[model samples]
Target: MKVIRIAAALLIGPDGRTLLVRKRGTQAFMQPGGKIDAGESAAVALVRELNEELGLIVDPTEAQFLGEFSAIAANEPGFEVNCQLYRLDVAQDVMPAAEIEEVVWVDAGGTDELHLAPLTRDSILPLYRSLQSA
Candidate 1:
């Protein structure tokens, strides 16, 4: 199985909601990110991805490292994904751009209704919830 290495962000708003985005032609909503390019640091990749995918400007130095996680890939049936995830608490406005078709702000604990990527559902959200309760 192939491994997709990515850098993603858990974007939190002033209202305490987190953002999830659905790419065009994809059913499962996931964190806004993309594959880490060769020689690019995770934070830099995440900042670039945020700008390209969500039309949001961010500083790489401000992204709080939330550790790495791995799960079965959401869109690739036989592949896996390893994500370098970060928590970014920002109140900036975001619009879906590039491949993103839809964006949603959801309560961290109230995401049962949406079809989420496996990485988001099985790992990231649980971690986020635990961090919230800490």
Candidate 2:
């Protein structure tokens, strides 16, 4: 089995909704970040991914490390993904571009309404819930 490693962000807004993006030609919504680049730090990859996926510039100092998780890829078969999660607070108004088809701000209670990646549904959502209650 091949494992894919990625770095992702759990961007939270003042409204307490989490930012999610639907990639082009994909039905499920996922976190804003993407694969970690060779010779790049996780934080750097995350910052670059945020800008690429959502057109938002995030200050690295503002991002908090959540943890690492692994799950089966939502859109791929026989492939697994390991992701390092981080949470950041940002403005609610954002324009998603690059390969993202649509962006949604979903409340923690409404996670079920959004089709999320396995890692997101299993791990990230729980963290989001905890943050909401904190």
Candidate 3:
């Protein structure tokens, strides 16, 4: 299987909902991030993606590394994403632009109406909930 190295972020709204986004023509709602580019650090890639995908500017200083998780890619077949995830406690007002089709904020355990990316359904949210319970 192919593996994609991506940098993803968990953005917490003031109301405590976690932000998720769907790309154009895609059904799964995942974190607002994308693949890391060549010669870019994970943090750099995350900052760039957040700007491109959600119109939000993220300072490298505000990112809290949440380690990495891997899961089958949600939008790709025979692929997996190794995600370098971060937690940012601040919520920048996000508008869907570029390739984003929609945005939703869901409780960590609540995804009843949304189709979640594999990294989100199987890895990120579970890890987040576990961290909260710790």
Please list the residue runs of candidate 3 whose C-alpha ends up more than 4 Å from where it truly belongs after superposition. none
**lDDT comparing candidate 2 with the true structure:** 0.86
Tell me how far candidate 1 lies from the true structure as C-alpha RMSD in angstroms: 0.8
Clashing pairs in 2: none
lDDT of 3 by residue, 1-134 (tens): 89999999988888777889999998999998999999999999999988888888879788999898999999999999999999887657898988999998888668867788988988888877776667
Clashes of each: 0, 0, 0
1-134 per-residue lDDT for model 1 (tens digits):
89999999999899878899999999999999999999999999999999999888999889999999999998889999999999999888998899999999988678989999999999888888887777
Off by more than 4 A, model 2: none
- Give me candidate 1's TM-score against the actual structure: 0.97
Better lDDT candidate (1, 2)? 1
Query: Model 2 over residues 51-78: C-alpha lDDT tens digits?
Result: 8888889988788999989999988889
Q: Candidate 2: deviation at residue 76, Å? A: 2.3
Worst 10 residues of 3 by lDDT: 125-134
The positional error of residue 99 in candidate 2, measured at the CA in angstroms, is 0.6
Cα lDDT listed for each candidate: 0.92, 0.86, 0.88
Residue 97 alpha-carbon offset, candidate 2, angstroms = 0.8
